[model samples]
Target: MTLTIRPAVPGDEAEILRLVQALADYEREPDAVKATAESLSATLFGEPARVWAHLAELDGKAVGLALWFLTYSTWTGKPTLYLEDLFVAESARGSGAGLALFRALAEAARGLGCGRIDWAVLDWNEKAKGFYSHIGAKPTTGWEAWRLEGEALDAL
Candidate 1:
């Protein structure tokens, strides 16, 4: 039950990819994950824009990860922490790993003077929705999430 959360390093790429794919599978969108170790290494550690990650370890084994990046909230006029993905291994669920990951993100937001921390969950994932509610996160019912991917994404 003891968990340790820390920023990821280049050596953690494979583990991070595993966790990310697991998350995609859980969301019923297995094909959505296109990241490879080489690409992940380059994007996360390379130039242009840097993506960051935090890994959660239980009993010294990686059990979960949170991939995130910084974003600006024009309305708030401050930076925000955008949690791109959060995943806990099936065996690690209910062991407080998820909450620990969330707290770690919140702590980072606080340290950076971030105006907010934002993420989205599938509507059908009742368990996840309930957990977020239990943690006092309200769903933004007024907003609809939109995305452009594949050809459309590339066209732009």
Candidate 2:
């Protein structure tokens, strides 16, 4: 039952992609994912990395991915750990892999003096909502997420 959470290295490209694809499938947008290992590697391992990730291994097998980056909180005047993606394989969901991954992220935030950690969950994913609630995360009721992308983003 030993679970290990470690920073992703270059050799873990394939595992990262596999876990990301699995997450996409669970989110019901399997084909929406266009991230390649090359893109991930460049973002995570390239000089002046803009993002980072943690890989969770259970008994020597890859089972989860937690990709994140630092974000500033203007009000708090500190940084926050923004968890971009968190995915645990279906076979490992209840085995505490997800919990371990999140705990690791919290530790990363603490180490960096971050004010808090933030993430988004699809509104339809009740399972994720339950897990997040179980971890003591509250929904930000008044704030709605907005996006500027595609043609709108290009036009601006």
Candidate 3:
């Protein structure tokens, strides 16, 4: 099967949401996803879209997704592509879809003159870590992932 990666367009919300939920499940956060097709459409296709996504298809069948957003990096003095999620369907695990998605992201970064690409992998996902290493991606050694969401975010 031939695999292709392309930027998601307005009508892809359903497929994108499907891949996102699958990703949440893979990350052991099955119940954490609250995005609906409408929400995804608003975020990904609404005016001044804050996030972006790419879909990976094999012979016209959607099989993976790479969701990301841009962030400024003071150190690099340029925008950075922050990958929010990367997932390939269980049946397509070893079909190169993941790498194709990543390659597409890299191409996008290069085109946008982004300083770098960044993502976090769960510590327990050794397979993902290995794939990242194989792709020449090194984990950041000095920072811990932190979050201040929900009530804490609202309080602040």
State the lDDT of candidate 2 residue by residue for 1-156, as single tens digits: 778999999888889999999999999999988899999889889998889999999898999999999999999999999999999988888999999999999999999999999999999999999999999999988999999999999999
lDDT of each: 0.90, 0.92, 0.94
TM per prediction: 0.93, 0.96, 0.97
Among residues 3 or more apart in sequence or in different chains, the pairs in candidate 1 whose N, CA or C atoms overlap within 3 Å are none
Model 3's alpha-carbon lDDT is 0.94
Put the candidates in lDDT order, highest first. 3, 2, 1
Candidate No. with top TM-score: 3
Decide which is better by lDDT, 2 or 3. 3
TM-score of 1: 0.93
Which residue pairs clash within candidate 3? none
**lDDT tens digits, residues 105-140, model 1?**
999999989999989988799998888889888887
Which sections of candidate 2 miss by over 4 Å?
A: none
Model 3, 1-156: lDDT tens per residue?
Answer: 888889999999989999999988888899999999999998898998989999999999899999999999999999999999999999998999999999999999999889999999999999999999999999999899999999999999
